[model samples]
Target: MNIKELPFEHVTVKALDIFNGYEISFVIENQTFHFLIGKSEELLPLNIKHYFKNQEHCNICQKMIFPTPFGQQPCLPLQKDMKDLLSHLRKTYVVLT
Candidate 1:
């Protein structure tokens, strides 16, 4: 689906606090997703269809997140959110270019 088809809110013009950590969530139009920029909670309107892109890792979780298929990672189920996000990001960006 096109990025437009996937409803989202542009929560940031540019990420404000990477020091707190960053997470991009994907959600269905009628569902909910949780996004944590720092200690505060940001409720997203859509259900997370995925989680990470560009091989960016979670400093807290220390998981190999985003930009999958880049490294020979084992691909664990615990990181499903990350996996889904990576896939969606790849698809979206590849088409945009």
Candidate 2:
């Protein structure tokens, strides 16, 4: 499941404080489901791994970035997309389930 290949009709990404990661919530097969992933953690998914592996990491000294595995810092556009997803989720995330 490549992160980029996920046909996210609707999705939400929230940063997790206790674990220092993020939770991805979305609907699939008519069921609401969630997946958790952490930065610099062993449990990082293969999808994220594969996705980041194919991307170009930030080489410049000063720039907003989304850090990936092995000290790779990709730019912040991907992070921005995640924020947009969160906003979309909030519009429908009324129940605190």
Candidate 2 residue-wise lDDT, 1-97, digit = tens: 2234434544667777887666665643333334445557333421121122223333222333232344343223334344444434445542222
Error of 2 at 79 (Å): 23
Candidate 2 clashing pairs, residues 3+ apart or interchain: none
Model 2 residue 14 CA deviation in Å:
0.3
- Per-prediction TM-score to the true structure, in the order listed: 0.28, 0.36
Q: Against the unseen true structure, what C-alpha lDDT does each candidate score?
A: 0.37, 0.41
Determine the C-alpha RMSD for candidate 1 after optimal superposition of all C-alphas.
13.9
Indicate the TM-score of model 2: 0.36
| Model 1 stretches astray by more than 4 angstroms | 1-21, 35-81, 93-97
**What TM-score does candidate 1 reach?**
0.28
Name model 2 segments beyond 4 Å from true: 1-7, 41-43, 46-97
